[model samples]
Target chain A: MYVYNDFDETFVRTRVAQFRGQVERRIDGSLTEDEFKPLRLMNGLYLQLHAYMLRVAVPYGTLNPAQMRQLAMIADRWDKGYGHFTTRQNIQYNWPKLGDVPDMLEALADVGMHAIQTSGNTIRNVTADHFAGAAADEIEDPRAIAELLRQWSTDHPEFQFLPRKFKIAVTGAAADRAVTRAHDIGLVVVRNDAGEVGYQVIVGGGLGRTPMVGKVLRDFVSKADLLPYVEAIVSVYNLLGRRDNKYKARIKITLHENGIETIRDLVEDRFNAIRAGFGGYDQTLLAEIEKSFAPPAFVTKATDGYEAARLANPAFRSWTDTNLSAHKAAGYAIVSISIKKHGATPGDATSDQMRVMAELADRYGHGELRISHEQNVILPHVHQSDLPAVYAALRKADLATANIGLASDIIACPGMDYCALATARSIPIAQQIATRFDELKIEHDVGPLKIKISGCINACGHHHVGHIGILGLDRAGVENYQITLGGDGSEMTTIGERAGPGFSADDIVPAIERLVTGYLDLRRDPSETFLQTYRRLGLAPFKTLLYPSEDKADAA
Target chain B: MPPRFTPKVVTANALLDGDAVWLTEDDHWSPLMSRAELITDEAHADLRLLQAKARASEIAGAYLADARLGADGPEPVHFREAFRTRGPSNYPHGKQVETPPQT
Candidate 1:
């Protein structure tokens, strides 16, 4: 994790003071609601359905134990006893008091964190792969670029008020864990034919109402020119992006209106003009940032204990099979602590659970933790020999669920339950599905499934990329759910195709159960996953199961 | 025949606590839906909304929301408003923490 310098500390302290004064002004009738709305949003405070929600950014999904413990303290003291980890790899306190938000910001800054740039129509938090430096397949650590982008975009004079909110993600691995293809600006590190490491910059990919994959504007941008290159793209967008309509203001819409080639030409022209302005300071800064991410020293440890423990305990073996990922170090493993316990709200963690995770990080994970975009906690450097002990600690806290990629591990946004923008409730739907699936004990049989639910078309749940996507909507003043099939968020990414009419809230869960059970019958075997089967056979079969009346009429 | 506007309540989140509150008949903000004044007439509803909006120090986003007087009191006609009166479905918190779950 990158420690804050005196300059960064001063910068955050100043923002806290500014926001505290702004809050006081609003209280004294000096700043009207209209005037304070943008200011509050700039600090990541949003008035939701029940209370004010505060979103805190965990930069690049990296946090030390002290920061994690401070987050727990904030949750317990200022807000509710728990916080919701979002798909953006950040945490949201759903019941924060408006007056206490300034104090909350001060507490966050005390731990070298802040809520600035977490919201508003500006460059949002820069996300990276949770297993960035620890992954075996990574070309290089992507956090260096992610941090550079974070510093450059934060309070940038020209890009602060973009046409719409911009999102950027970077992934260093061969596998697409960061969902880079779905970001407004996705950076995939690539090694060229000449053995040069550079970024394959993809633009215009987004997942709101209009879901579209990004186009590759550049095949490879060297590290030296990356900052200038990205700035040029944003600059071109700042000039050409639509501001007349909020819905049509994203860069994706810009790319849709003007062809990719023309936009690429504009960006390249701008890049040439402004490349010298960077003055080569970004490269030196990047080198300094890279030094902060040096891998921990490897300690030689025998794996006989791990093998014996796994063989002795079936539950431990199952959890290891489900939640463990390949680590770059021989004796180390990446442990994804499943925050989505069965039938619970997907990403919520109580303050006690937060403290437990912090302790686990300090004891077993070299005092480091990562938050996955899927809303799970990641101990990026857990040793293989310590897996049994970690599993025991997690189980005691009800955080040890052996479901990572299964149907029970669902992604859901805080829908109508908390968000003001949501049209229907998403958490209940996710909870019902997970609970129903767990009761049947066939999730492991279903195997490698992704069910993502979004409350509305905002796609905060990343439903656009789920194998089975459930979108909640308001139909005739009642909650309705629409199903989509064949969406994948990996390198072979595609937007899901909608299956016909929507189902009522009461009918949606059962409808999903039927679809999955039907999938069990239609699959070649348990070995073939949901996406593969959906690809082999089109939506015709699943559609039949989801809307049986339509299939019945066709049969008649 | 002209369509009748449904009964309504002026509702907003409290500026300090951010909890949902409704304007009462006595010009005070009440956290309980039962205490809310249901404005039946359109003109009166607009006036009440304006009055609520003027209380900037007390509220953040004031607007008229659809409601109807039921056997008990003002009942939310839409699910979203009902959810606002209660709390999130996943947890027993907010106003509904004390009130029994509605069937």
Candidate 2:
């Protein structure tokens, strides 16, 4: 993890003090609510449905044990006893008071974290693959570039108030774990014909009211020129992106209105005009940042204990099968501790759970933890020989759920429960589905399905990219859910297609059950996943499963 | 034809705590939605909302939410308003901590 230098430390503390003054002004009526709204949003404070929510950025989803412990302290002191890890790989406190936010931010700054740029129209926290450094297939750690972007974008004067909120994601592996194509700008580290590593810049991809897969703006931008090239794209977007309507303000719409070719030419022109001024400073900063992310020394430990534990304990074996990922180092594995326990709210971690995770990170994970965009905690450097001990500790804390890519490992936004913009409650729906599938004892059978739920069209849950997407909406003043099928957020990104009409909140779980159970019958074999089956058979069979009555009528 | 106005309550999030609060008949903000003054007339509802909005230091995002005059007090007519009255569905926090949801 990147430790804050004196400049970074002072910068964050100054902002916290400034925000404290602003809070006081707002309370004393010196600043009107309208005036303070934008300021509060800039600091990642928002008055939601029932309470104020504070979103703190975990830059590139990286955290040390100290930072994680501080987050637990903030949750226990200023807000509720738990925090909601969002799909953006940030944590949100759902019950923060208006007066307590400054204090919460102060605590965050003490640990080299902040709520800055987590909200508002500025470039939000730059997300990267959760397993960036540890993944076996990775060419290079993406978080180094991500941290560089975080430094560049934080309060960048030229791009602070863009047409709308912009998001960027980076991934080093070919697997695209960060959902790269679903962001405003996506960077994939690739090797060129000359075997030189550079970024494949993707532009204009976004999910929301209008979901679009990003187009390749440039095939390869060298490490020396990545900053200038990214700046050129954002600068072009700053001028040309639509601001007349909030719905159409994103660069995706801009790319749609003006052709990508035109945008590409403009970006190239801007890149050339400003490329000289960069003068290799970014590369120097990147080189410095890369030093902090160097992989930990691997211990040459015996794996006999790990193999024995797996043989002795079926539960531990199942967990290892699902929650562990291949690590770059031979003796190590990336452990994804599922925050999504059966029937629990997805992405919520109690203060105690946070502390336990911090302790685990300290003891077993080289003092490193990662918050995946899928809303799970990653012990990114756990050795296989220590897996049994880690699993034992996790089990004691109820963190050892063996459901990483299963139906129950859902990604859900805090719908009407906490969000002011939500149309319906997403938490209960996610809970019910996970609980139902767990009760049926078929989550493992369902296998490798991504069920993402968003309370509204904003797609905060990335429902647009789920294998089975559930979008909650208010239809005639009642909660209704719409289903989308065959969406995949991977190297081959595809936007989900909506099935016909909506289902009532009561019917949605059964509808999903019918669809998944139906999928079991339709798949060619066990190896054929939900997404593959949906792709092969298309929407007709799934539509029938979702609306059995319509199928019956058609047959009749 | 003009649509009939629904009975409404002036509701907003309290400025300090940021929890849902409603304007009572005594003009004091109460966290309990049951104590809210339900305005049957559209003109009165609009006026109450305007007055609620004016208390900038006390509240934020004040608006008229649909409600009904129940036997005991005002009850939220929409699910969203009902959720505001009692906290989130997933946890028994917020108003639910003080007074558990009645069925």
Give the clash count for each candidate: 0, 0
**Tens digits of per-residue lDDT for model 2, A486-535:** 89899999999999899999999999999999999999999999999999
The DockQ scores of all candidates, in the order shown, are 0.83, 0.86
Judge candidate 1 at residue A292 and give its lDDT. 86
lDDT of 1 at A325: 95
Best by DockQ: 2
TM-score of 2: 0.99
In order, the Cα lDDT scores of the candidates are: 0.92, 0.94
User: What's the distance in Å from true for residue A224, model 1?
Assistant: 0.5
| Residue pairs with backbone overlap in model 2 | none
The 10-residue segment of model 1 chain A with minimum total lDDT is A291-300
Question: Which regions in candidate 1 have their CA more than 4 angstroms from the true location?
Answer: B98-103
